[model samples]
Target: MKTKHPYRLGVDLGGTKIETILLDPEGGSLGRERTATPRDPDGPTEYARIRDRVHTLIEAALGKVPHGHACTIGIGIPGTINAQTGRVQNANTTGLIGHPFQQDLETRLGRPIAMENDANCFTLAEARQGAAKGYDLVFGIILGTGCGGGISINGKIHSGRHLIAGEWGHFSVDPEGARCYCGNRGCVETKISGGGVAQSFFERTGQRLTLEEITEGYRQGDPQCRSAFEQFLDDFGRCLGGLISVLDPDAVVLGGGVSNIDELYTLGVEQVRRYAFHERIQTPILKHQLGDSAGVIGAAWIGK
Candidate 1:
């Protein structure tokens, strides 16, 4: 008799959203659920909210699990995660600081769980099952809140010497540029992140507008909005050009809120090609197909 393979659960915990997905070993999403991330300024309040929201989402996903059996769980956290301690180091989620997130979740679910940075997970998912499926080298980028990146070789994450080989967003692109939330000046994130794009628009037009507003303005051919959007595209292309020079990966996949813009891939490819030192090679910039689910879906394969 053959032993049955266990089911798998993938969870993505972000400051703004929490997503959970159940999947089979073949990378198929069985069931998924998402909810707004609760805001709790106080430590205790935040922890309680996290616990409650996680439970609710997981329970909902569990009800949809296709198999009759339970499975192992994996989580992608949006911060500096210490796998050994399961503690979230520095991150936007202040309430989760120093919390043994993996351990606590394991206790609640009655199973061991794997955890890693969400960007890393997303990269793996894209490389293994999404747009970069056939590539040997894949880089995934998250251009929101701050920039986050992940690298995969041969469909596996290369954590590198310190498990940080994929943190490319923190790479400084301009030392004298705007100050970043990470206390660094002119980091690529400060120039190309979702917040950065909005801030740039505000600076140029003196109007506090949503990204959607900016997009609409661009679509309507507003000069100020067009300028901001075009600048963002150009800068984004320059960044990708630099990445291509360094990693020279087969393809790059983009995720996060900003990726919702239709022109990013097209404009980015043009810019990257223009700025890239290697004039003979053609590098493709692929849009993320999995969207928000990529993190959770990729996390499910952690340690597998």
Candidate 2:
């Protein structure tokens, strides 16, 4: 695609890390930067440090742009900025919950920038060129430590009127399920997310274990792990199945850490079909092709 700007820059601001990418007009990578997300020793994060880090990263990437070439910057945030207030909300990273993140960044850089929720970025990238390519209506799922999702129609992000179109994970399912960061009692996220799985497992067995360890233990015939993992799959089915019923996208692509679980495609998918509204469900649930690069790359494409 021909771009109005020769140099395009994008930032992927996630809960665990912050990454930046610079791309040429043809979408070739020109430069990249990544770092651990800032957090204080007491476990709470500082909004100032995060804001400054984003500023510094953008500045560094801007240095590589040719002097005469025009540049555009876009950000893929873990949460969406409220259109009314320009403040971030529903971020997994709690500290960013109420800050006017985009406004602050624009003030810092002395220019306007494009921004969208990270899951929207994920769906846009996939719908344009990745696993969900050619699908008119694509649903992108990010099953990481926390669950998130996005929607893309005809390769363009379908950010809803309120800019919360694909925030699928926050919808409460069980009235008595695990607690979610969004103050919901039983959000889909609190059931199928990696963190949610771990928390559920801890409650069940009174043991602390990572998602990897729990799955490994299940593979090794550990009774407790098997029980928890089976329930997890069922929960995955209930959640995704319900969403599929609602949107009925042409294709659904999965990304993030939890998407790598082999059983999700087989056993987990079977559950999706069983619970789905259609008697002959045909949604092609797929694995991501661009991997972690999708978010940042999509962000670049979004900015004019």
Clashes of each: 0, 0
lDDT of 1 by residue, 94-120 (tens): 888888776777678776667788899
Model 2 vs. true fold: TM: 0.93
Q: What's the lDDT of the predicted structure labeled candidate 1? A: 0.80
Best by TM-score: 2
| Per-model TM values vs. the true structure | 0.87, 0.93
Q: Per-residue lDDT of 256-286 in model 2, one digit per residue for the tens?
A: 9999999999999999999999998999999
Best by lDDT: 2
Give the poorly placed runs of model 2, Cα more than 4 Å off. Answer: 1-5, 41-45
Residue runs of model 1 more than 4 Å from their true location after superposition: 1-4, 52-70, 83-86, 107-111
Report how far residue 217 has shifted in candidate 2, in Å. 1.9
